[model samples]
Target: MNQQNHFALGLITLIIFLFLLGPLAIIFVASFEPTSVLQFPPTGFSLEWYRNIFTVSAFMDTFKLSMFISFLGNLCALLLGIPAAYALSRFDFRGKGLLNAIFVSPILIPGTVLGFTFLRYLIVSYSLPLEAALFIGHTILMLPFIIRVIASSMANFDFSIEEAAMNLGSSRIGAFFRVIIPNIKSGIIAGVLIAFLESFNNVDISVFLTGPGLSTLPIQMLTYVEHYFDPTVAAISVLLMIFTAVFMFLIERLVGLSHFTKR
Candidate 1:
């Protein structure tokens, strides 16, 4: 009976994986079609659509902008998130509960609502640049996930090691950098992957923050799809899937996927 139950669970998991990844597989196949229109079974395989992705100058610029924003936003999120998670997990203070809730509040709020609020506050109230506002907005969106992942990693960590480092004459800051961070390195990498992907793929918040010149790759794809229906978008999607898969493989290789889960 136990073996039968295990088999059933494995079957269900496989079905779910296929359901989620089916469209991506379809898009990958469609991207290679020789014909201008998107079709599953290509009349003949060609890389024309993939090559066409570069022909659109906006795609290149937006891709660069997306990479820039995601890198900065994810970095900022990590810088803030690591310390925030450490404090929340290691310290006790007044309003700690409130502060923890607030740190992760962005995840609970609707992205569209957050975007609209940022638009009003950043532009109407303070007149900040679109790029600056977008950076801030993406960082806010990324923080909760980073904090949550790192905090969970830290929860299972043994604090005695940090204390041991301090007893050996290491300052508190030094102990953290030398001891605690290395222990939670897996969580940091996982958080970075999640945060960067979220920032890169975000569309709702980016839509509000984007202007005439600055736009993310996702927004650019949306704009292109609005006017055109070619396989170039699928080609782009395939490339992004490859990019994301490469990162995931790296994460698995460096940290092992099991580190993300609680023991």
Candidate 2:
């Protein structure tokens, strides 16, 4: 690209980033305010808000609930996503395009539709546990992302490594573990991380499925925000953002962000 074009592109990108992050930046800064109401350019700063976060029994309970649910959701997505990805990447069958479309279309479907569809199924036919329903619904939402990540990784991996391992007397499972896995480790790790993140941040599905005596952090935050608008929510938002950033940073350091791409 020419210098002028590059400069213009950079300016546009900066504007976009600022637009996206400005509200979040304001929330983070206001979170430390030593006041009752959420405000910007605070009169003072203190750790009291975070301390208050710890004292809230509801926040702790909801945080744990979110962690547990996200874990289960990611597990289910991986169990189903990995094999489906392998099939789509490694083997071609009749109606392959149709099957692939069905698998991935969930990603394009709106979260509201996904939530309402699962809610209807649970209410009418299955009558499944709310937690299980949430798990399944989140899997529907996140599974496509996982499968696509894994498949993209698989595409970039050379199959000859697996063939070589098999030819050298490794068992099928052994070859997969010792050869294929190591080669595709980055993709799998990225998929798992992204799946966990998507599952963690889910609201639409969880909000619909959650009943009395159960709530995730996002639901709790939504409820809390509805009832009271204040810097406490901002405190929680900053904490959540920090936690996610640190986690993603660790993963990127270990696995390398490049691993997430087929290139």
Candidate 3:
């Protein structure tokens, strides 16, 4: 009976993995199709679509823009979230719960609604530039992950460490920079990696905020799909999958998958 159950569970797990990864495998194979159209069990293998990705000016331009937004947005989130996480984790204060809720509201809200709200208020009313709007939207989107991850790291932290550092002649800020920050370095890296992935692949917010001459990679991919039915997008998807996998591997190496799983 035990062997039967174990075999069934193993089979189920395998099926689930295939279900999740099957489309990715199809896309990877489809990207190598010789013809322009995306086809399953590709007619013949070729790297034409891969080469075509570079030839498209829009893809390169949007790739640069997406990279810029994702990097800067996560950096800004880390800067703000570290202090906020420290405050929430280490101190007691009035309205702390409400403040935390406010910080996390972005994740709770649907991206489409949030994007529309930003478009109406920031773009139409205040006349903010597309770049500025995108920056702010991505930053806000990242805040929840940053704060939550860093706060989790600080949860078991000993407050006395900061006191000890201060007693040793370090200032409050000095103790934070020298001791607290270094201690939670893994958490910071994890948060930034997660947030960067989120921001880079974001389409809902970028779609609304994007204007003429300013678009994200995901948005451009969507546009490409609408107008053309080709394996180029499939090739792009394959590259993005590899990129994401590499980042995930890095995160696991730096912070350990166990760190997140334990939380």
Residue 208 C-alpha lDDT in model 2: 86
Residue 198, model 3, lDDT: 93
Query: On residues 126-242, what C-alpha lDDT tens digit does candidate 3 reach at each position?
Result: 999999999999999999989988898898689899999999999999999999999999889988998999999998888999988899999999999999999999999999999
- Sort the predicted structures by lDDT, highest score first: 3, 1, 2
lDDT of 1 at 151: 91
Task: Give me the candidate number with maximum lDDT.
Answer: 3
Name the lDDT of candidate 2. Answer: 0.83
- Which lDDT value does model 1 have at 91? 93
| Tens-digit lDDT track of model 1 for 85-193 | 9999999999999999999899899999999999999977999999899999999999998998899889989999999999999999999999999988987998899
Cα error, residue 205 of model 2, in Å, equals 1.7
RMSD of 2: 2.4
Off by over 4 Å in 1: 1-15, 256-258, 261-263
The TM-score between candidate 2 and the true structure equals 0.90
List runs of model 3 lying over 4 Å from the truth.
Answer: none
Q: In candidate 1, how many Å is residue 230 off?
A: 1.3
TM-score: model 3 vs. ground truth: 0.96
